[model samples]
Target: MASVIIIGGGIIGLSSALYLSEAGHQVTILEKGDLSDNCSFGNAGMIVPSHFIPLAAPGMVQQGIKWMFDSKSPFFVRPSLNPDLFSWGIKFLKKANAAHVEESAVPLRDISLLSKKLYEELHQRGEFDFGLVEKGILMFYKTQKAAEEEAHLAEKGKSLGLDMEVLSRDACKSLQPELELDVLGAVHYRCDAHVYPNQLIKGLVSLLEKNCVRIARNHEVSRIETSAGKIASVAAAGERFSADHYIIAGGSWSPAVARLAGLRIPLLPGKGYSFMAKEPEGRMKIPALLAEARVAITPMNGSIRYGGTMEIDRINTRVNLNRVRGIVEAIPKYFPDLHPEMPAEKDIWFGFRPSSPDGLPYIGRSKKLSNLVIATGHGMMGLSLGPATGKLVSQIVSEQQPEIPLSAFSPDRY
Candidate 1:
């Protein structure tokens, strides 16, 4: 069995470790932090097979431009002179077309369905409870424009063999009778589900450690040694670790990690924030995505988690309270009966999402480094796509056929 070293112990890295260890490989995870908080946790926790459209779809450029001026808007791209950002923007513009969206739908749907199936299997094992619920998610929209867009997406979802239905405001209210809704309509994505991410991450870490997978926390990779087109070892925290194979799953920090090996990954960090609020009534039976506002609210762990905003910029520790307030304000606009107070800055949880120019994750072996597998740039769908990406990484390392074609997710596509 091959010995593997996975960098960045976020959902992608942890998931990769899970599958690799299960495949009889000696696996070790090197995490920069203490594994208590990461992008894997503090997310909306929705496992959505409904998000078929990539972030680089048509009209996104115009929409993003309009949103740039608003401090509390759902999307914001900081104006910068960085050449990487310039290059990424050009590539994003090139791919932001109807054809790109059409071509990406199948690959996204297939991987999402695969991940959903894997989540179901994981929940069935009963090793740990992550609060996996399949009650589906509701995409609520207030305006006719948003409703029309959601209806169109629902039709596309139906065509892709996903269960989805456009419902009227009355129908939506019938599902969540306790909560008063002020939406024009909603699309219930019956194929989607939710999980408590905090439980999921903690449970997976415990299970991996019990299965003999070494998790080295506070070990940040600073150097990569390559020999004859393959990774030889990784140096982190002034210590050297050698493995037969290396996988880079380092979320927003992947570009820096890859740069050590003389590779450039065209990616950016999209900062998002979320906070928990008490929902004593437990009135929200279904997770909701505010269409126009771009916020996600999910009921988990007997509380409600509200998250949103996509601030494309460098990774930083700054918390934008305006964005969090936007999330708090939008909740009451949709669920008139539910009003969550704005959380303090300390209560807000922010993480950087590694976003690729083309909106597809990079999940294949690197062409320059033979023993390295690149798996990051999942953007907003990291938790949603974790298991499927991990399974594919294991297959690639094992030299076996992947469950799905890898052309769409090739790391060397650029």
Candidate 2:
């Protein structure tokens, strides 16, 4: 069996390690930060097959431009002088179309369904307890126009055999009995599941260790040693280690790391912000997506998290107060009974979602490298797609046939 080396020990890297080890390969995961944190730690833990729509859907370009100027808008693109950022923006705007959306929907839904099954199997095996809930995701809107647009999406879901339910304001209140809901109508997908991010990350870390997978934390890969068009070793933190195969699951940093091995994958970091209301006053029993605001509020095992805002800029760890304020502002529109002090606290947390211009993740072998696989650019759905992506990568490394078509998520598609 080939010895596999994976970079970036977030959900993608850890999941790959788990799958690779299960396939009888010796696996080592290299993480640049603490195992307990990163994108994996601060995400909306929803396994949503209903989310077939990619971020680059049509009209998003114009909306992004408008929101970039409006401080309170949900999505914002911070202006920058970086050429890569400009290139990514251009490609994103160009690819936003019905055909592209259609091309993306199937693979996305299929992988998400596959991943949910895997997660359920893992739970049955009793690997971890990360508060996985399956009551479904509620998409609520305040206007008839919003509800009509969402009903079209619900129709599409129904055609795909997804368990979808449409609800009126009274019906929505029945679903979420405690708090006052300001919605006019709702589209609920019963196939979705939610989890606590921190719990999942920590539990997986323990599970990987139990499986004899080596974890190299706090060491960033500085250089990659390649010979004869294959990986020889990876240089990180003044040290080099050899492995038979290498997987680049480095989230927002995948592009730069791939550059070391002479591969160009256009990946930009879409900065996202979230905050948990410590003792949240209002009630949010089922996870709901505020349609007009494009924000998600999920009730974890303990805390309720309100998260949204996609800022497509270079990977800068800067927290935009205005964007954070936008999430805070957008929340109360649907849950008008929520406490007003939600956004007042400056204890803000932010992480980058590795976003591709086309909105679909890049998964599969790199065309230029025989032993290197690319699995980044998951964007908002990385957590949802982690297990399936890992299983696919492991299959590729082990010379097994892919379970699903890779055409929708080809790394070299661009």
Instruction: Give the alpha carbon lDDT tens digit for every residue of 233-337 in model 2.
Output: 898878898888899999998898898888899988888888887645436778989998888888876567888888777777677787777777777778877
lDDT accuracy of residue 302 in candidate 1: 83
Predictions in order: lDDT:
0.94, 0.86
- In candidate 1, stretches whose alpha carbon ends up further than 4 angstroms from where it belongs are none
> Can you write out model 1's per-residue Cα lDDT over 1-414, one digit (the tens) per residue?
999999989999989999999999999999989998999788899999999999999899999999988899999999999898999999999999999999999999999999999999999999999999999999999999998888999999999999999999999999988989899999999999999999999999999999999999999998888999998888988999999999999999999999999898989999999999999889999999999999999998789999999999988899988888888888889988888888888899999999999999999999999999999999999999999999999999999999999899999888
Estimated TM-score per prediction?
0.99, 0.97
- Write down the TM-score for model 1: 0.99
lDDT computed for candidate 1: 0.94
Among all candidates shown, the one with the greatest lDDT: 1
Predicted structure 2: lDDT: 0.86
Model 2, residue 181: C-alpha shift (Å):
0.9
